[model samples]
Target: MSAKYGSGGWATVAIAQSVGATGALIAELGWGVTGPQRVPRLSAVDKSILYRQSVSSRATVVAFAVLPVSVITWLLCDFSRISAIVISLGSLCLAFSPAWFFIGDGKPGQLLAYESLPRLVFVGIAALLIHYDFPIGWYGGALIVGSVTALSLSAICSHLGFFHWKQNWRTIRSQKEVVLGRAISGSFTSFAPALVGLVNPLAVPVFAAVDRLMRMALAILAGIPNRLQSWLGAATGRDRHLRSLMSIRYNCYLGLVSGLIFGLLAPTFVTVLFAGQVSFGYELSALSGFLLFLICTSRGFGLAMVAAGRAKHITISVLCAAGVGVPLLCVLGLYFGAVGALAGQILAETVGIVIQSRILSMKWKSNRQWSTYAASVLQS
Candidate 1:
């Protein structure tokens, strides 16, 4: 897409992606965050019920949000209005994904077959369209087609039917804390590009470039915490504490190593991926890498807390981070451009890590037996 479209076009795509992602996050209703932990505990029948409730609740939210989200994208977009709106709508279609369902069910085959494969195929098709000089709107249409197709296949295979609105609403209310935390956290990341674009159009492409790479890498790294969520959720007593301790240690190492590698390789990645169209220097790339490390480490702590049923602490941390980060991101983007925004993200994630770690430590202190077991196990 970058090769086909220059900086201006890429900026518009970034804005559209931002708006669509924000809408999709709302439509997901925090299911992706909390679902994995819940799935391991549910019976087959109950699992189906949960999936139905999630779909029903998320569909209703998307029905209401589509128009407003498209309007927001249009307003933020300085390039092509039609293309932006289409892409925004395409992104919103991701709400239908049943990935969390499959993950929690320990069915990677289902996830790959029904969700990942279809999405990849459609994305490839979209690329072909772009290469052929087809309207960019076709790219968004392809996303919609891919997402809906995957949802349909998953639903049919899972034998899902009948969505009860009241039941779904109740489910949403039950998970309100998780939903709120995810919403705030998702917004800060998804909307940052648009916010920066509002201040510095020139910085949008550069910021968007690094942000895209960070997001892609983070998506792959997400498997670690997600796998831990399932493991910790299913475990009890000493086992759970042991897994949590291991998660913290390994995630810390993963963050340190991954951040260093990404910082060193980011310039080359930009040059290769964008054909040197996007100007990303070492200093900015290094800062973005630091931000990525903070994010990965913070996510590890937050997901561990969630697995331990400490959703409220995660929500509080997200709220605090947003309170500090949002204003800082905008101000920094206004003055120092993308570098300032990256710094703001790093600071926000640092705050989240501190709060989550503190909460987890408190929880450990209250559970003396588990804490001692974990410490001794680590020593051995």
Candidate 2:
């Protein structure tokens, strides 16, 4: 079945594929960032005390994943590419923008000067673009991808206890490492997309468009693992077993909590944002339920990646496989339509996650089963 927003079925596939490619490129940033100079400069708004103090991940989660919604809006709104470009930039700026807090030796409430000054400026530009309703699908992602680059470095910085993370020859190496790592993640991701498509072609695009925001929102926890590690390392950082257990605790609890929130809110949020009207179908509802389930699953998976080495090794693979699976799903859609396509995707993701989980068990220093994983986080 074809939706008329863009060019119908095939065009949807092309756009979806393009998004996949972009996601792959961005995944490299988080999977790879290694040093401080490599760290992206933050904008003024991002640096501001007000924004940092006021903004909560819970409140603004919908705003972050606006790419898919923006695309849908553009299709329906008939907004100019210029508008789209502006919107995308704004989102990208937001995605990249974060104010650094001392949280330590300095004022516990203070902003890191280095991070604040630049973050303020950049996000200022971004905020302007956002108010204008810029289209964010095309490059917004690329911008966020760059943020992950910093995230990568942040990982090493925290592990080494280098609060003053900066770029160096070593971090430069991170660029390549990030891409390579993301490729690994993309390949695994392909499994989910591929199988889903085999079951239901419609599922691929449906999720691609809908899941974009949700996925990004869930990924916010990329910072949490480090936070956990840092805390564990602290004097009273809590018990080693307890600290280690934070891995599962945050993954299962934070993720599932977010997933539950997303499952409930994402539907209405995307509906009004993308469709320009709020509506939901049973299929859409079930799909939405599944979508949140997947995101919740990612919580444990992301921590697993951090624990193992890099998420890209597993995540990139799953996404890339899903990308490949989409077209195959279309063929299946010719027969089974949406549900069948979704079935294909579900099976693929299930199988792939299982395989990846197995790999994680063998490869991981500590392994948490998925069921237990979700439960742990839920308790947290």
Candidate 3:
């Protein structure tokens, strides 16, 4: 897509992506962390009820959140407005997805079927369209078609007892804090990229392309560890402190190795993949790969924190990172364009991971102390 559309076309696509991502962030509302943490404690019956409530609540919130943004994007970018709206609407499927249920249940296959399959189909259709030279503007519509198909399949599966959903407003209300934390954290993360688009129009495509590719790569590498964390959290009859420590240690090791390997390879991959159209992407991809490693190392700790009821800490860390990072983004973008923006991202991630790691360490120590005290009391 970047190759065919050039920077201008990719810029439009980037705008659409930002809109969709923003909606997803709002829809997720911190459930990515909180759901996994809380779901295990509920009965199967209650899980179904919560799932339905969560989906409905998030979907409703996303609809309201996306509408104004769509309108604003429409007013601001005449050419890409329709595409942006279509893409953003398609992202609503993410809210309805049963991955959270599957993850909570320790069912990876179900998560893959409900979440990954539709995305794979979307990719196939997109590649076919792009190969045949379909109009670039229509590509966003393709995303909608794919997402709807995924939603329909998921719905069918849920009906057949492969997944669960049972509406309950009260349960949804009970999760208000998680929802708020998710929205705030997501907003801080999403704001930086959107700001990049506004500050440097030309850089949007380059930055977006690299970011997208790096994210795809990281998802593939990080999927297993991510699933494992949820499973470990939900596991019973085990030393949770030991599990948490082991998970963090191994995850960091894996992330460090993966980051280094990908960082070395990303430049070559970018050069070949985009046909040199996005030459600047090589450096950005390298930086992004390193950042991905840092993120990977922190993922276990972050999930552990959430499982320990530290979602607020995660949100605070993200906000602090954004506070420090956004100004740097604007300054770097103004002075050095895309490269500077990429540098700003790296800086921000570094700050975020440091803050997060510190908090996680504190939480771990607290958990250990409390565990020792409880053990002594039981013995006495």
Candidate 4:
């Protein structure tokens, strides 16, 4: 695509992706981080209710949110207006997806069938379309088709009574702090990358492509750590602390090995996959992979904080990173282009990991001290 349409097409896709990611973040609303904290503590019935409410609430917000974003994106990307609209539609479908229900239930099979399969179908269709020299917008349509199918299946599952729906606006309202906090944090987390694209609009494709590749590497390697963090969140007392430390250690080792492998393979991967149009970011990809490793290693502690209801601390940490990272990205991107953007992102993630680790360490030390003090008093 970059070869055919040049940087403009890639920029369009990148912008659409940014808009879509924002929608996903709005839908996520810390659920990815906080769901584990709540799921294990709730009864099965309560979990079902929570899932339905979450889906409904998020869907409602996304419907309203996506419209303005889509319009703004379409206006901004005059070169790819239809493509932007298609991407926004697909994003809206994703926002309303019920895959979270399966995730909360620990039904990986259903999640795969309902979430993964449709996406695979979309990929196949998109490949065929592109092979036949169809319009780029057709790719977006394929995504929407697949997403609609997945959503239809989710609706069927809900109709079959797999989930319980309860209208609890009061309860939903009560979680406003968490939902808004996570939304703000997530927005900032995404802002740096998007800002790079906006700043160096011509380099959008290169930056976005490299970021996507690095993210894929992180996704593949970080899965285990991600699940571990979930389990850590569900653990209690000494068990929680023990598991947290163990998870961090295990992921650090895993991340080192994975980062090494990714860094070694990334140059070759870019050469083959992007046919060298994006070779500029080959080294950046490797660097980003290592940074991703750091982020994944620290994730368990972050989850533990969320589990302990320390969302404010997490939010503050992210805000600080964004405040520093965004301007750095713009400055670097203006001067160094995509590589500078990548550098800025690494700086941001590093700051985030450092702050989060420090906060978690302090919390852990405080807890240990209190535990020892209580034990001494009991002994006396």
Clashing pairs in 4: none
- Candidate 3 per-residue lDDT, tens place, 274-323, comes to 76766553466667777777777767677666655576677667777677
TM-score of each model, paired residue for residue: 0.94, 0.49, 0.87, 0.88
**96-150: candidate 1 lDDT, tens digit per residue:** 7888888888887888898888889988898898889876777789889988888
lDDT per model vs. reference? 0.83, 0.42, 0.66, 0.67
**lDDT minimum window of 10 residues, candidate 4:** 159-168
lDDT for model 3 comes to: 0.66
RMSD of each: 3.9, 11.8, 3.1, 2.8
Quality of model 1 by C-alpha lDDT: 0.83
True-vs-predicted CA distance for residue 315, candidate 1, Å: 1.2
Q: What is the lDDT ranking, best to worst?
A: 1, 4, 3, 2
Question: Could you give candidate 2's per-residue lDDT for residues 146-232 as a string of tens digits?
Answer: 444433333343332222223333432444544454444443342333334444444455544444444556455445543443343
Error of 3 at 141 (Å): 2.7
lDDT for model 4: 0.67
lDDT by residue (tens digit), candidate 4, 22-135: 666666555666665566667766776677676666666666776777776776575768877776566555665555455555566776787678888886887677667766
Q: What C-alpha lDDT, on a 0 to 100 scale, does residue 56 get in candidate 2?
A: 31
**Residue pairs with backbone atoms closer than 3 Å in model 3 (clashes):** 30-182
TM-score between model 1 and native: 0.94
Q: State the number of backbone clashes in model 3.
A: 1
lDDT value for model 2 = 0.42
Clashes of each: 0, 68, 1, 0
